[model samples]
Target: MNELGSRRLFFKYAVPQMVGLLFNSIYLIMDGVFIGNRLGRIGMAAAAISVPVIEILIAISMALASGAGIMISDRLGRERLGEALRIFKASILLSALVGSAVALLGNHFCHGIAGFLGATPGIHDQAVGYLRYIVLFSPFLLFSFLLGGLARNDGRPGLAMTALTLGSLSNVVLDYLFLFPMDMGIEGAALATAIGPVVSVIVLLPHFLLKRGRLYLEKATIRWKDWLDILRLGSPSFVMEFSIGIITFIYNVAIVKNGYGEIGLAAYLVIGYMMLIFLTLFLGMAEGLQPVFSYLQSVGNHGKNDELLSFARCFFLAIGISCYMGIVLFGRDFISIFSPEEIAMIDLAEKASPVYFAGFFLAGFNILAISFRQSTGRTRSAMAISLLRSVAIPPVLIGLLPLILGRESIWACHSLAEAGTACYIFKTTRRNERWEERWENRLPRYTVEDERTTRSGPSTSRST
Candidate 1:
């Protein structure tokens, strides 16, 4: 990583992650498409409404994974190979415990949870049925996600990408089989998603077991300090992932309350699914960049770290603008894939698409800002950005905008929130130098001798 040019390093990590994430999103989109076509509009709405419940679990897994992964990356960068391996083992064990707890609670409260998420009577039963299976397999899904992060941080990005790809491909195959051949309806889509992570776990197990990188699975006690550190670093990521669920829930309630009803909810789902593709680009880039940023910081390569951030800002902005333009030109066709027979739903989604997505042009800036902070261990700043963007801002805008500007303004809420957040991020970036300076002290400084010594150790630790 230190020897490579900035652009080369960016592409080396970001491209595979982007491609893998894109492919992962394909099966998810496929699940939505199959459900929309086979089970109709209410089916699509049920799937969308269930997202919050799913994301809550995913948020927990990601929080633990991202937090521990960042810590592991930093430890390896500091030549603390043994410490890194311990963090990895502890992370897996904690994830399993959390997954077990969720499986027990989530399955028992599936119906209540579905109703609490604002599922209308028409879709409530279906939502409950779909959610049950998703929660039942929580352990596999959580571990799969956690393992991917650890593997990527261990300098095995290719393996991580491969695991995600294989799992998603299997999901697509299973989605088709269960939904069409077996005629299982919405339940089949849920089961397909639940099963994908199992495949991921299978593919990723070898990275640790075979000792492909600096980090390998080993016996480790769960230390409170380690868990706290992981949670502190990872809390922002959890919020980032959790925000999607919150945003979806807010939009669903807002659309329904305004009398737009199921068609509007269905419309939101279409746009949301398409947005997922764009989100994957930003998130994949951020995840890919995290280890690089952590490693650079650990090795005291501040100049390279800043340069990479600059490149990320420009790269993400260009991608975001290109995506919004593409959406403007081809949105109707995209929406049609999900709701081919429902002209009203398609029309509603198409109309809402531009207004709802205007923020895409500026979203990359905000995402990169949050990612930079998280990667560099600016946990407080990262958490603040995530909370404001996902938690605080959405509700106020979704609630107040419609009251003042009428229900049509509902579509503008997300756009306005993102634009506003971009301004905040710009200001925060300028003022963050002091905090960055403070955080820099905590990371180790490696000299040439230290690097050589680290490399020559029993289990050589090298920054990729």
Candidate 2:
């Protein structure tokens, strides 16, 4: 990290991660495209309504992985290899237990849960069909994402990227096979997605088996405290994931209520899929920076941390602005990819593109800030920012705007919510500087000294 300029280091780490996550995001878009083209707008709406289920499952995995990933990176930085290994094992085990339970329970109540998530009568049956396959294969989805996070943190981002890329490519080919030639409909789409994780796991196994890496799993007594530590550190990530699920759920219901019903929802799905693409880039950059921040903070290298933060902020701002311009200029073409001939949905989304996407420029910066806070031991600030952006703010704005200004104003909800939170993050960082100064002389329980690698890499003992 010290060898490269800030820009070079940032891109070196972030680009692979960005590409990996882009592939992951493409999984979502591919599902949308296949479902939209074969199953029609109703199928698209069914898929959209089923998204909350996917999000909730992703939330669980993200919470465990992100929390443990942070702790593991911190331990590795301090040369506490044993502790890092323990946490890693515990995280994987915990994910399995939770994932199995969700799969079992979700399959049993698949239709009921679909109804509970606000699937309208017209789309309810298709929604259940899609959700059932997704839930039954929940273990794969959860583990795939969790393992990807772990792989990234274990100094094998290239492996992580490769795994996700292959998985996504498999999904695209399988989606076509299952959806078109097989005529299996919505369930086929879900199965294609469920199969993606299996591919990722296949690609990821070599890392653990060959021992071509730093992190390893051995027999370690899994403790309740370790699990709690993982959960506690991961709460912000949970909130972020859960908030998106809630927001998606709420948006589905709001679109239906606005009298547009299925057609309106189809349009929203197009916009939502596009949002996923942009979010992956921003999220990829933040997650890529995570290890660097954790290492720097462990060694008390605040100056380097400050520089990274600055570079990331400016970099994402430029990316976000560039993306917004592209969308404004070529939105119809963008929307056309999902449903080239479905002009109604395309026109609706294209017209609302500006308001719908206005927040991305600043939103990119806001997303980076959350990751920054999480990496630097500012969990409370991170959680607050996460809650406001993902859970609290967007829903309120989405609900209130249509009621007050009529339904046409609904497109502005996300932009307004994002802009508001960006302002708060800006102010809070300044306030946090004062708090940091007050506590600079004191070290928290979690802080540890830096470790130097031996010829073997990631030596277990710290340098004296």
Candidate 3:
């Protein structure tokens, strides 16, 4: 057992990351519940339509945060303490600037993008009211993401968890207070949700300012060139989510062409949120393995590295089974939140999630392989898998599947891609193992001058 392999490590690091993302998902469900119930069907559909746009914002944030964090973790693991600090501080600056830009640009052209994504002329105002408020809160959203990554990498995932939990909790409580009570309408829900992340940032900032922990804010000459690694390393993950944005827009288009329009749009949105919630389970396991992966790779632990890979695969498969079973058994309950008007839609949602999620088991493998390759200083392999899964395959699916299977094929394409990429990943990883072994064997060996040498006499023998 190494310094990091203790049970305490798992409970402290993994649990908090799960708790953070869990609170995030819980509040998302709450947001939907509040809007769907209080606002009306139009509101529900409006919120659903807005998801892809926000996903792009989130995709950018996650790209920098997760990708930079992985690199930061590996740097720390390798004892390059100074470089890790630079990377963290630099990541924050990049995120803040980029996030602010997204907010402004998104708001400026909010209607245009919304229209492109299938916002109706009738409901245009509803989308505008909500997006405007959400955009205003962009700084907080960006800061919260950057700091959350800092907290997790700093070995205080609890701090990050608390930040997100409070943010989510505030959103849930304020949704009732603002939207329901004040008669703020749909905008109120959006405002309340937006304000929640602002509070989270406020709470998180003192940790950075006071330098209370390992991850603290520092002022440095912003290294423009350093953005290269962040963008490069982060692009894969960003593309992973941003490509989803494209799929979402395409799905909306396909559904409309299929003649169901708003109904299909709403159903697709509900199923998408449900998928995110379940994907959190996959992310939880992936995140749990992150620090462990970085640490093991730093120590050059091949056996444990391979074990985590196996563990990740099995874990995701198990979760996929549970998700499929839930959809099969309680499909209506899954869609019950949308409304009693949603019975037909619910049936469709039920049929849609499993097919869309079928390769969720394989998704775990994709993530594990990427994580392993990244942590072990093999970003090229990570990037390749990422390219295969996110860029090349997803768009191709979007273009071809609907043409072949019609509208239902839109939802099914993602999982099919996941399953396909997993096959390529498994084959490539078999090759990667050989490389890992060569590196494993090359770790520093002890010299003749050793601790076993007795100070009393030259005759003291040393054991190698």
Candidate 4:
């Protein structure tokens, strides 16, 4: 990475990650499509009710993977290969243990969980059916995320992309087969999603098994402190992901309270698919560049760091503008993809589109800001940003705005939260920049000891 030019490095990492994440999100969107077309509004609402559970699972997996990835990247940057390997081993173990616990507990309590997620009596059984399959296969999903992140940090972004792409493609195929010919319905969709990660795990496992990069499977003492460190560093990512579920849950309640009911949920589900694609793009870019940021910070390459940040800012802004425009121009068509026959749902979604997505132009930058902070060891700042955007602001706005304005004002909550958070990020970022500049000036200029060590090329040694 150090040897590559900034543009090349950015593309090298970001493109594959983006492609992989895009494909990964495609299967999720496809679920809505299949449900909307086949099972109708009731099915879509049921699926929506189950979304929080899946998001929570994803959140836990991402937190562990991202936290461990950051630590591994920093260690690799500093040439501490042993420590990196140990963290890698611990991460694998932790993911397995956590995933199993979730699966067991979640399956046992699927009915209660479904009711808690705001499922109506009509959709409650379907929600439980969908949630059950997902929880039953949680381990595979967890491994998919953990190994993919480790692969990226291990300097094999392409491999990680390949694994995810394969998984998503397989899911699409399974979704069609199970939903149409087999007539499996909602459970089929969840089953397809759950099995997709198994394929990804298979593809990624060999990289570590073969010792293809700096990190690989190794026997190491798993300390409680390492677990704590991983969770601490990863808390922001956890919040960021978990907050998706939180937002959905809050929005579902708000929409219900506003008397929109299943129609609202079905419409929101379509909009949520669009949101997922855009969010996946931002997340892919941020995650892809995470190792680069960690590496630069570890090596104290302030100049290069600034250059990458500049490029990322421009890239994120362009993407955000383009996405918002796309939503404005073709949102109706996008909504129609889910259920063209459902004119009421289509009309509702179209009306809600602009207001709901109004401030998404700033969302990518906010995500980038959080990722940059996390990679550079500003975990608190990252957590605060994540919490503000997902947890603090959005919910408050969702609850208060509807009462203050009209019931229709509920659609604007997300946009307002995003816009407000962007302002906060801008202020804090500027302040941090000034402080960093002054701090750098106070220190003597230091040169990198060796480009090779700093680059931290792939490791071939095996550990047991």
Best by lDDT: 4
Off by over 4 Å in 2: 2-4, 119-126, 256-263, 340-344, 402-406, 435-464
Candidate 1 lDDT over residue span 1-464, tens digit each: 89988898898787677877788888878887788778877887788767776778778887888899889889999999889978888888789888898899998998898888779998998988888888899998889878888878877788888988999999999988998999988888899999999999999998788887777777766688888898889998888877777788789889999999989987887888877888888888888888889999999999999899889888998898899998899999998876588899999999999998888767677777777789888889888888888878889999998999999999989878888888888887667767888899888877676677777864355343
Q: lDDT ranking from best to worst?
A: 4, 1, 2, 3
Clashes of 3: 0
Count: clashes, candidate 4: 0
What tens digits encode model 2's per-residue C-alpha lDDT throughout 82-181?
9998998999889888889988999899889988877999999999888888888888887887787888788777787898899999999999999999
In model 4, what lDDT does residue 247 have?
Answer: 80
Off by over 4 Å in 4: 119-125, 259-261, 403-405, 437-464
Per-model TM-score, in order, reads: 0.89, 0.88, 0.85, 0.90
Please report the TM-score between candidate 2 and the true structure: 0.88
**Ranking of predictions according to TM-score:** 4, 1, 2, 3
How accurate locally, in lDDT, is each candidate?
A: 0.85, 0.82, 0.73, 0.87
lDDT tens per residue, model 3, 36-140:
778877887677667766677677777777777777777777888777878888888787788788788878988887788678987888988887777777777
- Residue pairs with colliding backbones in model 4 are none
Q: Residue 24 of candidate 3: its Cα lDDT?
A: 81
